[model samples]
Target chain A: MHPRLTLALTLIEAVAILAYAISGFIEARKRRLDAVGTFLVGFATAFGGGTVRDVLLEHRPFYWVEHQTYVIVLFVASLFAPFVLRTLSRLFSERALLVADAIGLGLFSISGTSIALEAGMPAFTATLMGVATGVFGGLIRDVLCNVVPLILRDSRPYATCAFAGCWLYLLLDHFDVDSVYSLIIATAFILIARLVTFKLNVRLPH
Target chain B: MHPRLTLALTLIEAVAILAYAISGFIEARKRRLDAVGTFLVGFATAFGGGTVRDVLLEHRPFYWVEHQTYVIVLFVASLFAPFVLRTLSRLFSERALLVADAIGLGLFSISGTSIALEAGMPAFTATLMGVATGVFGGLIRDVLCNVVPLILRDSRPYATCAFAGCWLYLLLDHFDVDSVYSLIIATAFILIARLVTFKLNVRLPH
Candidate 1:
């Protein structure tokens, strides 16, 4: 495994934990769910993607076991988000969700690709797994929140961004690029692709 | 597999397909989803567990490939379900869901355990895989639907039923019991145990 890539994945994991935790809290408020319900939704959203990947790979002890702090962080963030994010959303002209979601897509895609490479899967499968890992958490979050999946719908470029970014990462690595350079380049592709798609209202029909 | 056990498992699979398909379709309607959405949800509910099991085991072609009828049946059923199941649910109650889920659990647990044993996995690991095959589908579906997962929630016999039934099936098979007898016995154990838990509102706390 590439050490720099591992560090990058950890950073992305932290970002995702924070973003999903906030989103979960916001959705819970929209549904008028109780505190327990809010925390549970947040918790699922935070862990859903990585958990699925770990299970698929037969990775023992699971990633969450080694990093229990992420859970504790999400718990605290969710508790505070309702007070901060909800109020800010009412006042800000910009949409916080779109940016946060884009960042999350980038982070998750990068993390997923790295993990797949670590497991020694081929590039094609690694790209698919990466995109799946990035988007699956949100897929699950939407389902539990009683909404349609963002990925299956022609709603936006959510998964496409992940796919594109992962491929770019893999392509660069094939050329034996520097790890940090590849990480930045790949993550930028995801972030930019997602943001551009969202801004232009792009959607995939199939 | 015992010839007789195979037959019993077939019956259980059919019943499970119908039950989960109905539940999936019902959830789709509640969300006002399109026909595609309805069908996808139904398919996931019916075959998601087995698919996950096959993927984990690196089994080629997957279960649905051999049993293409299962997918077709769910597809056809989804179109008519919104109308048919409402009337049916009124009479049968959610008990149908429980019974069907239990049947699937029993069959899947047996298949998973037997496969793992064949592969020479340790008994503990084999048992875990068996439980996963039986229960992981619902967990995946719940995540997709964005609802608190039934398995992880502190309020259900859920995975416990699968876990218990897998061991029972293993013990019976170890004794070279008649395949048909083991199938029937294991299925009954899961179904009765599951139904009783539901009627009594049994659940484990986190």
Candidate 2:
């Protein structure tokens, strides 16, 4: 991978992690959890999906374990979550959260799919892994919060977008598209699809 | 390391897995899940703790993956869960379920702690890992059932027994006790502690 692409991916991942952590902080606040509980929930939300993916793939040195900085950042942020999130919520509207979360869903899904494929998983299983990577953090968050997972209950096309994007990534890679371009395109595809579906209130049939 | 001890451990593990799967089957039935959902829940309940332990310890070829027979058995049992569990429930009293679950908690916690120690984890982390391994399957089951995990909400001594038992195992190992004896002693400690606590209606202070 080119240094430029690696750098870009890292930045995007940081954004995604931040988005996830904020959601966890918000939920923890809603539950009136203590600072420690807030931190644990925030950490789980930020790292849970990647951790689950790495575990399933039998990969070592979990992403959070590898990136101590992310853990430290989340820890510090969680300490002041109640105050920090209040200001953040005032600055960033719900639309901003939606955009950030959509981007996270896309990038995490494609990256997870790519890693699974590289690990020689079957394509179908790889796609499922992608969806898992994209959604499992929130799933864990909801579980910790004692609520039904949004992906399972919400009719919206969250994991569906990731699923379609993963297949698109696989298709592009199969057709010999440039790796960097394939990633960017598939991620963008998911992001746009997610936003469009949310805007249209598109839902799966009951 | 003796074959006899290995066989004994394996037998205990099978019993534990059956207990966990039965709990999951019961929960899924209560939730009125379809056959597929029931199977997934059963599989998770049976394997979730060990899988989480393996993932945390960076162990490969998950327990269920290595023991394909277990997966097949659970799969087959899940297919007939509604009828099978009904009959099993009639034959086994609630006391039976409690006994099996306690045995599972003991075995899984000690094994998890032993594995973590072998993996060179610090003692505190290993003890937590043991508690996680003992409680996580039921935690996952509750999550899938969209309920707060029993470990988190219940003021029972479930995870407490695992935690204390793990420390006992660590102490025994530190004293150079025979490995088989250490395992058996620690497991028995947890099993008896759990059963006694339950019978006495022990509750953590609110």
Best by lDDT: 2
The residue pairs in collision within model 2 are none
Give native contacts recovered, as a fraction, per prediction.
0.20, 0.20
**Scoring model 2 with DockQ, what do you get?**
0.14
Model 2, A1-206: lDDT tens digits are 88987898889888888998888888877776655556657877878898889988988766775577787788678768777898988999999988988988998899999999999999999999999998999898888889877889899999999999999999999999998899999999999999999999999986
Rate residue B10 of model 1 by lDDT: 71
Candidate 2: CAPRI quality band: incorrect
lDDT, candidate 2, residue B112?
89
Candidate 1 lDDT by residue in tens digits, B15-79? 87677667677776665555545666676776777777667677654465556677667756665
Chain A of candidate 2 compared with the true chain A, TM-score: 0.96
* CA lDDT scores, all candidates in order: 0.72, 0.86
lDDT of 1 by residue, A145-173 (tens): 77767555444657667877998998899
- The per-candidate count of clashes, in order, stands at 8, 0
DockQ, all models: 0.13, 0.14
Where does candidate 2 stray beyond 4 Å? A1-43, A46-59, A63-139, A148-206, B1-6
- For every candidate, the chain B TM-score is 0.87, 0.96
